[model samples]
Target: MNLANTLAAFPLAVRKFNPRLLVHSPVMFTVFIGSLVCTLVSIQQLVQGSPVAVFSALVTVWLWLTVLFGNLSEAIAEGRGKAQADSLRAARTSVMARRRLAGPGGPGTFTEELVPGTELAVGDIVVCEAGDLIPSDGDVIEGLASVDESAITGESAPVIRESGGDRSSVTGGTMVLSDKIAVRITAASGKTFLDRMIALVEGSTRQRTPNEIALNVLLASLTIVFVVCVMALAPMANFANALPTPVVLVALLVCLIPTTIGALVPAIGIAGMDRLIQRNVLATSGRAVETAGDITTLLLDKTGTITYGNRRAVEFGPADGVAPFRLIAAARLSSLADETPEGRSIVDLALEQGDGQPAQAPEELSADVEVIEFSAVTRMSGLNLPPGYPANPGTRVLEVRKGAAAAVERYALERGGFVPQELEEKVLEISATGGTPLLVATFDGTRAQVLGVIHLADVVKPGMKERVAQLRAMGIRTVMITGDNKITAGAIAGEAGVDDFVAEATPEDKLAVIKREQEAGRLVAMTGDGTNDAPALAAADVGVAMNSGTSAAKEAANMVDLDSDPTKLIDVVGIGKQLLITRGSLTTFSVANDVAKYFAIVPALFAATFPGLGLLNIMGLHSPESAILSAVIFNAIIIVLLVPLALRGVKYRAVSAAKALSRNLLIYGLGGVIAPFIGIKLLDLVVALIPTIA
Candidate 1:
């Protein structure tokens, strides 16, 4: 923050003293009322020609300073976010969109005209060509392209955005790279992804954390008790034949209330969210950030969370006694119509290894062929062709199947073929190395045989094991869930160093795992980017969704990772723990400081009336006037000094919670009671030098 920005907050600080806001902080509200009373008393004393007129004016001035310092702490925290919001808003400039027009037929034609992006409406078709910026959040409906998501994700590499897949959705403000695409805009003007992201990071709609509300209630109760204690003191002084003045009672109440922590609580909450925005993560509410600190178990999917999700075909091996060229043709034929990255990789691997004979183009197949899609339930996906067109349209038409090993074995056996021992051994060898072995088979009217296996390789994300170790040190357990076979899941779980693993998991199995953990009285945090993971994401205590994930997964989550890195949860958890610890340490210090303030002021108030009360002034403050001014100055100045500490949290050490609490208590609780005495005595020495006041 610059000097100009810091000075800009004075107006906001003064404006926050409205009746609505003051009521939220009961301690500050009570002090506000006391300041008003002191103002009225000072004016009355000046009119009556009182002996201590100057002292009354000084007390009233310092009381208002106490409240203003509290408001300044909050305004400083909110200013940091407003500056970042301005920068993000600058990146969302409106541009011209190419409106795709329909021909005499329907919404499929592609002759378009340019118009401002702000003029685009929901469900409207727009054309985005190479080097063009995507005007709004939408899905591609016509062509394929590579999109640079650096505007939102901060990644330099471009990602593919095609018409009919999980990755088709494109965010506004990103640039296109390869080919033209017709997109149907899902959001209208002023409501794009960048707009929501800007709103979330700016903290305009933030709700209070649960811990904050509970602490406010406790502080309000304490304020009421202190109010009653101050009201009874006039009667006690009357019994001593000398009544205390109204300004003296107000000063005592201000010092006794827990104003230090009460002032800094909101600042701490806003700063926590600001820190998350700097780290390129968006939290929907402050409550979710607090929950990250309490998470006991973390449930993560195998793909994209622990390992890179791009499972590609790395090697192709033919079965014993089968020609390599024949097996390569079948693998390519089955994957021709498959749109998944895995399937396209298989086709690419086969095409690179053709023999001397000219290879058959997969597009040359006749109209009788039909494409079968992959499914979780069947555990297989391939072609289903009718006979007489290529092979036999009557009984079988050269069905090429590829899927899990057991699924392919059952398909071959039902067609009167047996699984060879060599094929089984190859599948085991591929799986034990953490590679997914997809079995390819052929079924015809006269024969049924296993062709070969395609080895799909996926790597564990770099540095993920170290991040998992950090979670373990925080006392959180990790579990890996995937649809791969048991052997493949075990290999990944061991390599990732997770605590447990569940293999061959379906969508229902993912939900069941989360429910089982919740039943064991553990708070679970899940990270996922797939549509199937949406249900479990909603069931977990904290669900951090990837920005590259589908809309269903993003909508179900409480937090979103703009960088799409799963390791960011470690930073989020540490931030949550720091927020809780900061609040606790300040609360302890605020209460502890009162013990020293009372010793400085009580004897000074009574020593002139009863000389025997001088024994209580252990620090030997100069006089009643100097003592009162010193105590009030120290009370107000401490709020200003702690503002920086509140903005940047206290230093956090990864250790046991008990040990952490003990160290903070020694610093804040013990030091708070002693520091104020030294500060007040130093100020009293200066006040005594003023001949008019002494």
Candidate 2:
């Protein structure tokens, strides 16, 4: 929309007419060939002193203008990307990075050495501290920090970036706001992710989408049909004793073919990519954006994608015969080495309820203990303490375990402990309400104790119900997939308003779900950020990866969300639907424009040969010359008038495809057929006033 960019388009528009470029568009090149022939004929007629030579020259002028206008529409679309690309280029400035220097002994030393960011190679180590820009896209090998991703996400809020797991990768150009991190550059020079994003947004790397190519094939066939129809008309006119001039026949051919949509197709595509960039999503290909529109099933993970994702422990409930204070102490001990947000929350919650001086940070329990990590298979983890503790063990190392109720119950029975019926009822009560209940129990040498359950609660994100409603309106089924128990998953699915759900799903289940949907002829889209999600992400029709996720997930995904907001998928679906609708509407308009041209030029060209044909001129256009000139002018100017609508795309409403199609057909379809007739008539009246046009 910038005036400067619009002005810059003029030169680019002119260059687009180069024969090499024009040749690629079969429909447009056919028009160009006709225009070229009209030019040669008009020049010859002018030198011959023919009485109707002026009209021929005028017809030739309008033909070239038609081609130029089409070029201008695409150039303007490309220009918007050029302007944005320039801004992104400004952020990619070369700067010095603190490269890690090796110690003479080994890879032990990380002494700093300065090197240009552009010169840094893959596998080279670099360190960045607070207020420093991350030199390249890489994984954090050591340390933790908060990073400002505003350079990409445009959000001012800082996000945590820590070593280990899904949240460790940092993008080039993002700033570290606190602490320091040592990163191993994962991308080579000139091949960074940002460079690819820049190319994509600019549409420099764009290949025609499958649908677009198919549309082009149809359009080309239509053009060929129109050409043959126009050519056959010349012989029919000759047989009727009044053959029209070559210019008029050529004009008829150009008008009948669908040039309006052809001119604007490239522009519609470029603008779609620009819209994605504005939304802070980076799509590797236009095909992904288009595929998103056609998705019938949306597979979303419950953690992060549906709920707030950081599950927090809210309360501890003691089993019958277990002391409340004893349960809290055991719960605290169980989560000591569990660094997951839920585990940390349990430790913090226990400290808050303990009868002691309130501390800002919970102290680690002092004991010689071996940490047992939780696994998706076992669903349990806790500490193995060699008890000099519970004060003097007989011979066994006391084991304190916490996990899913089923897992913990099995563990208890093997150690001579039993879960009280009250505790089992309590776990069921928590699960029914959509809370995960981790059963905490301890086993000493002689006796095993069933302590209690820790309740982990997660909040469903706000506005989710409304967004799900929008998806329903669009006829897209929202399916929530999760590893949570069935009751918990169902409760959350109902609360969130998702259309369907899959509970207790493993990584394999996620892939199986997508495959089933696809096999049923449904296109599926899913959002994920974990390395475990890579295969499912790759299998889905459209995979949207969170920027805060691991590099493996980001690499597998075709689209990346810079804001790391799972709910932003709604905005993405909207943009994708808009792109397809815009193209469809314009193609309808382009075809409709031909009806008016058919009425305006055909009758005027043949009226003299068949006197009764003049009755077809409903507008009472002054002469054959005026009719052809007016229609040509209208055709050239309409492309310009339509540039804004094509770029902004049709206004999207979250209605069913049938309703949306009906609404747009009435507007763009019916309106396109009617408006051109009125416009050509108004222009014919103006042409009648021009003495030279006669």
Candidate 3:
């Protein structure tokens, strides 16, 4: 085993006597007294008789004590390291395996043994049975099933998967729900979609946060101080007879050093991470949590972040002087074959608005008509009526419900019909208030028939604006990225009070925007919930994926939010900042405590050298055993006190880096100085309260 690993595996009691532990000044002081006690006893025994046995017995006892304590401390550190490793491994295990079926002639039978370069023919059933892992990335050829993609996406719910030509694609590692699926492997084993996701999650482990590096440096520097203190004090105390034996001095030094360092720091970090988990936020990488506190920019997906993703139709308009019932019937008839939310809403409104019983089926109308499907890019739905409808001669009406006021206005202007000025004004007003207004019109060649406007609005999530304000208060710039046009994006951004907006952005465009922002040296935190956002989320400095988001997005993000609340970003940033501060405070106190131990030990070493100076006697006032006990107890107590602080999380306010640094210094430095005195004094009181020493 390596030195660090070996020390960690050692028993706690044995580790207490490790040379590294005793190297601290406080421990060395204790060892100096222990050696003095040993030598004085040995000399007395020699003067009396049986010098050989007496010397041998004393040496054996001293060596046994040293080894026992050293091994004890080593064991404690080792156990803690092992536990941390176990937690990390558990996190890795959460990545589910992807599996695919193979024929007898195929490269592998079982999914577990499948290699990267395996090939398969078309129509071959790649079965993904219940509880079976997905083996490769492929489109579902058959079967309807739900996949539990939480591990991959951070989403808590299971997603339904169905087979079709181009619409359904299954990733590796997703659990098959009800029925088995036959998939044609699109990507080979290691190159599958799940494999890439696993690679991404695994890659996060390599990136260490600034806090972790700082703690490591602090520990290394303290270790050096500890070793130097032991080396310088051992001989000086031995020559002056302050410590009668060198072995006692060495043992004390070993106990003191490791007690303060190896045992304390890791404990604080582990506890802090556990606390963060309890807050419903999983920080896949420690660095992510660290960076969250310092994030200066937050890029949000507009659809699901600030606004409820579902779109609902709220208003319908028909031409004046025309019966409202006729308009309703036409809209219902035209929308019957459509399944989009807007179409469904119109059909429902027609049914509700009609005076008598609603038409049981749209196909029964027998009206010769033309239907145009709504496309995301065009943002419109259209229907053309034939002369057969309404059973009246010379009646032709074209019904259109289109998104974006600008597109509809242009279409109307081209038709030589000016949209009423009041209608245009109303549309602008609604758009400004964050409502998506769709213009519904009915026209028959000659004089245009203006159907009343239909307004469909995406619901605003409560408290979203307040959360955006909080992020801003913390100095995080909020940018809204959406596929919606300029008007819709602007309206939402204004309502949400976002700092900036990027409209008409596709998934690829979003990625480009993120890259541009990154090039500007901004630490961007991207929040998203769809597969389209995977690249951008991955490219961000800190990717926060919602629990309800697509598996791809979740896989790409460094952190997952169970609540999926955009406002939770505020909480995350707060927790991250507090974690860094807590860790910094703990490390600072640990090192400062080592410095105090040196002060307590160094002055005493010289007290006996000059009787007039009274250095050696002053040093002898407290035995090495007492000093070692005091240091170990103090170190352990500090760790215990810090547990609650990490659990509670530090209260952080948004401030400049300078202010933050200054505040942290004051809290850590002042706390470090005062903690030991109070801790040691309490120990002394408790010791005094005891009946007697053995």
Candidate 4:
């Protein structure tokens, strides 16, 4: 096929669209039209026996070839991507299930093809197993098994399931693990959870941000400028009888209106995302890297992101008369049956303290006269003991341990005996230092004994303090948000060096806080790892989720850290700054190159009669062919040099706003001016070394 016809046919065949080709940049179309005009002028001159017409025809032909090649390259690349996606979709379909018989006498197998809303009968086995995708959404009728839910949830964890009733739902594409199960189809193939998840991912891919649209617009504008410049100058040159002027103008248009700019822009973004992958971070949106650097506030979840997220009992104090070991034994036994993280921590600490052996089971503990289960409102649990062997008989004391400092203290004051002011002061002091204080109280129906305190602390991550300092240095405010009580949250925030702390914050509260920060003109970055944290993560300017986090968190976050290290935030921010600088530098240099083309080609076109203007043209740079060759070579070299810059990011710090703007303008703007002279000199030297045809 001819070049124009091939370019037109390619996109339709591949199901791809190029907006640039559709709108038809007037400037570029003008350049093409100008070349056609020059060809006509050259033909007229040839008929009139003018030698200059031959050179003009050559230049016109060269420009057409260049434009043709550029368009063809773009069509091929786009076609390859579309073909690959189509192939993947086909492969996915092939692996999907088709109807099969479940044996004779079992619902009487029929040849009727099933569609959406097809009712499934009981005892009909859907026949799904490991790696064999389920054909439809269903509920388990019989058997028990585990299923891999990675495809739907983005969580690689396997979930165990047991057959019961209508509430048990199974998704298509999930892999069955271990035992096989009979599932009665609830929803047909197209309406399953898997279908919905697939739709969400596909929809996400289609949603482009404003920045991406702006970049595309800029590229389109440049293309138009290149085309217009060529069209305007080509006819004027024909009137001057300038030899090779039209050919050189055609070549200049091809070189200046680089079609690759549009193609390469997306390629650069993809490459940046690849770099993030190497660092064990997944960038959900291609533009996230750019957005991350602009963040002014960082909101971190207190549990996993700041503290170790695991609780461990660290300190113990007994009542004045009670022995320390006795209190420990009672606490250990009380925690034995508890599965909460705090209870486990207490039991584990007690075991370790008593020579690495767990406390005897709850059944083995001294008979409890009365037991108070943990209550969220009261924040305490207790076992009331009857006065026995050695102690006073009327002292029917309740041994209690609770989470919150204020609640425990208020309970102590209401049922007071010995105030234990010293103990209370010590516990409050520890709480302020970021330790979780558990109040151990003994109450005898009316009066309460203020027993000693038990402190459980979340382990601090190594280098956490230094990392927080680095964030502060970068002018990014760091805040801790958690569901933990005020004392525990404040304690961890202090130890982690966070600038602010919000305690007892729910998912909605976190979202509100983020919105508030944004309203104050801060770009907020939030890190979270819970289903509850999904809304806040989505609301933030940039959301970073741990790879080990809940599926909802990962799906909502802009970035995921595969290593689950919060410190990678620093590395990502650095990469974002580098990308911005690199893009800025490339754009400045590209525009400057176009400006230089105007200087080189315009003067040479008016050179024949305007002798003084011709004098302005450098020797050996008289023809459009030479200028076309120079511009193309220069463009290629600039793109090549940019490869290393993109790969190895620029080194930058979180500096004052003024300093940052000054540095960027100087490095990108001024640097663009200096680079071309050096590049041109190098190119001249290379050209001089090559042997020329006579």
Strongest candidate by TM-score = 2
User: In model 2, which runs have C-alpha deviations exceeding 4 angstroms?
Assistant: 1-5, 44-54, 97-103, 106-115, 235-243, 321-340, 343-356, 360-402, 442-446, 654-657
Worst 10 residues of 4 by lDDT: 86-95
- How well is each residue in 431-504 modelled by candidate 1, as lDDT tens digits? 99899998888888666788888899989998888878877887889999888889999999999999999998
Residue 449, model 1: Cα distance from true site in angstroms: 5.1
What CA RMSD would candidate 1 show?
Answer: 4.8
What TM-score, over all chains together, does every model reach?
Answer: 0.84, 0.90, 0.70, 0.70
Question: Cα deviation in Å at residue 163, candidate 1?
Answer: 3.9
Tens digits of per-residue lDDT, candidate 4, 1-694, equal 2355445535552332243552333333434555577678768878988655555555566444433333343343233234323332332232334343554656755333342233443333465555665555666666767876554444577775456521245655567876777666655445543443333222224333356567767777776776676677666677777633545665566556643344344434544554565576767665687787677888877666677777778877665776776557656644655656888778777667662444555565456445566776888765656665122222454454444556667877877755476777877777777777777666667776655677877777888888888788778899888777687677788888999989988778899999999999998988776667789888888888765455557668888775567657767876766566555555555555555555555565566667777655553462544444455455445544554443344566667768866776677556655565456545545544433300
Candidate 1 pairs with clashing backbones: 386-393, 387-392, 387-393, 388-392, 388-393
Q: Write the per-residue lDDT of candidate 2 for residues 202-293, one digit (tens) a residue.
A: 77788778888898899899988988898889988777765378888888788788888888888888778778887788888889888888
Worst 10 residues of 2 by lDDT: 355-364
Relative to the unseen true structure, what is the C-alpha lDDT of residue 195 in candidate 2, on a scale of 0 to 100? 86
Cα error, residue 472 of model 3, in Å, equals 2.4
Better of 3 and 4 by lDDT: 4
Candidate 3 clash figure, as a count: 56
* Per-structure clash totals for the candidates: 5, 0, 56, 6
Instruction: Give lDDT: candidate 1, residue 501.
Output: 90
Q: In order, what lDDT does every prediction score?
A: 0.83, 0.84, 0.58, 0.60
Best of the candidates, lDDT: 2
What ordering of candidates by TM-score runs from best to worst? 2, 1, 3, 4
